[model samples]
Target: MDQPFRHIIALAALALPAFATNARAEEAALIDGGKLLLTNGVTTIEGASGGGLASWATIAGRGTDRGIGLSTHVTLIELPDYGWQSHGVALGLANRLELSYARQNFDTRDVGTALGLGKGYRLNQDVFGAKLRIAGDVVYGEPLLPQISVGVEYKRNRDAPVALTVGANAAKGADFTLSATKLFLSHSVLVNATARLTKANQAGLLGFGSNGNDNHSLQFEGSIAYQLSRRAVIGAEYRSKPDNLAIAKEDDWLDLFAAYALTRNLTLTAAYVDLGSIATFDKQRGGLLSAQLAF
Candidate 1:
């Protein structure tokens, strides 16, 4: 071959390897199939779904990529005589970890006076959280092992003292959680279990505490999810909390959820949540909807 032709051939050969490397890197950055929304627990996303111990082996943190993503959720609850609502947004950075912020609004309806807070009393709280994947494979040839994650959250109450007494002094507090997850490739199912320690003063707003009381408690959360198709999944979760208040007895909640992926960058989730109750209020039930976007 002529010298010019030989030189061109050499340059083309070198470019091929670089292109292949870039392709592999891009594949690695994509989220794995077993975990939806880059979360280890059930569809709840937060600690409510527990971690890796139940049925879904999904990990909680983002993947190992250096990208950012966003998630938002809205929740509604129906009490015996009142209704409550909450909205939240979270940001994920890289695939190694995530940071999130959430706000909850509660409408007392007619139960406000019965709870000593009065009618139309609304309470709001803010939550800040971080999640880190400590171990496990993001892309694995074998399907039995799932990822592991560790995380924490700090909650601040924005409710006025006279309006809501449960979180009067709950200005700043923390929750620590650990999770383990595993995926069954043959069955297309994921299981996750998690344990947490918290002094959050409320379920951070799910309402499990009162003012003048601060006690550390342990909670267990678990979830199981099965992929119904390439873009859809169904799951459930259960959480156990503590009753650290002199005014109320904390109860547990169960959740059933469904999620659908619209595209590589977007997904939507919906759930039916039975919160049971927080004290003498024996009937509390709710629904939640969420959307997630990744880039």
Candidate 2:
């Protein structure tokens, strides 16, 4: 071969590795490696990211497939004449099994007096819950499809005598919920639906036999969300509760929320909830704010 031709070939070969390395770096830079905020119906679960309180179904599994992590939430709910607050944390082990513990404080603003329970009677309860994901993926599969999960919660009511008089059936009980979620890649939407079977007396802490009712009923919950961007999402959800007590009529609520991803390990969510009404009680509407962290 000619001397000049040999030199040209060697030079081209020397530049090949550099060109390949640059190409690989560019491809890696295009991939969004941060956690993705995913939602289904009223439930919001961590995607590639971790956890935040949005209510609804979320993508299952914790990390990539090597280990597990923990998700914690502090939630507050405000009603027209009453206000309730809950504080709890959950452990997501291997993204397969989840265990959670929560404490709820129910305060009677003025409704307590009408029920003859006094000025302010606070009812606190401890709730323990577990969830398992049986199918699907949120990271690698279709952007519009989601995973499925089955879970149950055991609640222990601590409202003693007051609960006996008003919510005579306010005892410990187990509630089961079946959840299904789907992510719409084309529209950037997430949808979720859930059905729960629960008892009337044990679920209603005020009293079951108020007007002569004592039984259980089925409840339905759903939510839909749209991804505004990689870091923001907007969604809404509805929950139907049973009215086992005659003194009050149970009603469902609608929620609108917007969430922001702060970092790979943290997220912030804000929501507005509207609880129609219970009997003559005024409609309850309030705001909810939550922060979540995962590792």
Candidate 3:
């Protein structure tokens, strides 16, 4: 198997052991799984809990205000000229603090050959993220109040040499995000909006910034969802990306997705995504599939 797939399998193996270790005398108190179905939000490409393509203000697990929770996910995206894969794990503490890790591998099929990087070249990156819920609640706060969160993500590109060769100023960078999310039970609707400060190019797959333009810029991520039932939701997301690389033009991303809870602990999501352009390849669109398990 490929190294990245092996790493994912190893990470999956740790989940059961870790959960078992925590299921001691205080198991009931720690793993209550009290949150409503689908309220925890699905995992993002960066591994934080949110919409399929955008980050939301919701926390990561099914834990309530007093319990701890764990979640893991694997996501795949297939494009005409590229393929994407990511897997990660997350820990939620008392539904207030969240920590996550995700590794993304972008496969540059024939496009790599055109770019003189050999066919099937792959770019890999690791993302480490942390989020803190500052105030309010996603489902129970005042009608006008929404859940608010602040988060930070530090990304490291594995192919630093390639990144630098593409005129990127650095192979690593950090991003900050402020998000707000609310679920209106009466209307069966969920809404989210996030503002991000970043300088990463192509979501950091190509690199961070460029010598000519190396400043962070404000970006936006918005989502609106309608709950079809207690365990199902359909939503659309829009994420604006910065064009910080002079070598290539980047475009915003959009997706229409549906998520369903197959079981209390397992949720499945599918989406059609439009990732405008990547490395000068325009009209890059694809389908996304993801599965998340939480407890």
Off by over 4 Å in 2: 1-35, 38-62, 142-145, 200-204, 207-215, 278-280
| Ten-residue region with minimum lDDT total, candidate 1 | 48-57
* Candidate 1 residue-wise lDDT at 98: 49
Per-residue error for 294 in candidate 3, Å, reads 0.8
- Encode model 1's per-residue lDDT on 1-295: one tens digit a residue: 4332343344334434543554466655444332344342322333222321122223233333433344455555555655656555554434445455566676777777877778877767766666655567433534655566666666666654532455434455667777777666568776777777875533566433446555667788887778787678888888777666555556777878887777654667777777676545765766666655534
Instruction: Give one digit per residue, the lDDT tens place, for model 3 in 2-50.
Output: 3333433443443444445545535467878999999999999999999
Order of the predicted models by lDDT, top scorer first: 3, 2, 1
On TM-score, the stronger of 1 and 2 is 2
Which candidate wins on TM-score? 3
Global fold similarity of model 1 (TM-score): 0.73
Model 2 lDDT at residue 52:
26
Cα lDDT of all candidates, in order? 0.55, 0.56, 0.88
For model 2 the local lDDT of residue 8 reads 30
Among these predictions, the greatest lDDT belongs to 3
Of 1 and 3, the candidate ahead on TM-score is: 3
Q: Each model's TM-score?
A: 0.73, 0.74, 0.91
